[model samples]
Target: MEFDYTMTTIKPFDVAVLAVEEEIVKAGMRVLYVHDVQKSLVEKGFQRDQFKIVEFCNAKYANEFLNADIKIGLCMPCKINVYVKDGEAFISGMRPIVLSQFFPHADLGEMPKEIDQIIRNIIDNAK
Candidate 1:
């Protein structure tokens, strides 16, 4: 089966970012940070396209996992990358639920699926 990590939108990056931010909070999660990855790359003197990364987490779910296995901290603060190239915009991020398969304790729990649906909605509804 093919796993999805990235998505495209007809809207420009600015509008898409707004939709993504609104969708995340509407899902009852708070955004942690919005990283300017393209700027970071530009500062390093490498020519690159524009890219923004939005990170977010829900405290309740986060705590549930931490209470299960501390190692899962490695994937905390799940994020989405918003970028524009050739006049097209896109949002990209790892499927935590899919990757959670490696951590049976976390996968078996309902939290991953709960969060996955929210993330999926954010991606699916963003314009």
Candidate 2:
């Protein structure tokens, strides 16, 4: 029943962020941009740990998957939340397969599985 996957690392939050980014690139994807959710929370008068979101994508994967069904574009650019908790850094995100099921295009060959595996591997390696 588990859908999202998360990994904890003794490394600091910034280090964990770099780890996730490195894994994504090693898999041949590009890290789109990082968002600091913690900063926004702090602006709201709430102190929080490092809570950033890292998004990445692979052009080759996207082109092929869209050929199968462009609707999959809605889920383009996989995202992972890089955060700190209890002095430990953690990366968490939904498995692409979990979201793919929402659309009928979930069974479009191995493309979905390919994307899922890449992102999952990124999270795992980040740990």
Candidate 3:
């Protein structure tokens, strides 16, 4: 699951985020919450309409991962964000596997690969 698509010019960040969402949905997971960052920011006095954070979780994945290591919970219930900048829509998110790099003892080597694939697929399908 290298998630390296050389044929397309889509930003890896956006693709990865969208891929995760699509994969989770295809896996029969439910969206627990969608925080509209643009609206929230506006309400908070930020003048912008190009930010959003999508929170999703698969119960089975979460449970299994948590049982494997509780510390991983800090990055659980993954989030993907959609935002606009310089006339382009950009997607951003935190890759759990990348985060795992900070903690070598955490066994997320296998899980991050799966997650990366999901994210790639999402980006591939984005219009």
Choose the strongest candidate by TM-score: 1
Off by over 4 Å in 2: 105-107
TM-score leaderboard ranking? 1, 2, 3
Residue 63 accuracy (lDDT) in model 1 = 84
The regions of model 3 sitting more than 4 angstroms off are: 1-24
Name the lDDT of candidate 1: 0.81
lDDT per residue, candidate 2, 25-77, as tens digits? 89898999999999999999999988999988888887876777677788777
**Candidate 1 runs further than 4 Å off:** 1-3, 85-87, 105-108
Kindly list the per-residue Cα lDDT of model 3 for residues 14-59, writing each as its tens digit: 4544554665587566667767777787888889846657787778
At residue 85, give the lDDT of candidate 1.
Answer: 81
Would you estimate the TM-scores of all the predictions? 0.88, 0.85, 0.73
Answer with 1 or 2, whichever has the higher TM-score.
1
Pairs of colliding residues, candidate 3: 15-123, 18-122, 19-118, 19-119, 19-122, 20-119
Tens-digit lDDT track of model 1 for 26-67: 988899999888889999998777889999989988888777
The stretch of ten residues in a row with the least summed lDDT in candidate 1 is: 99-108
> For model 2, what is the alpha-carbon lDDT of residue 85?
80
* Candidate 2 minimal-lDDT segment of 10 residues: 98-107
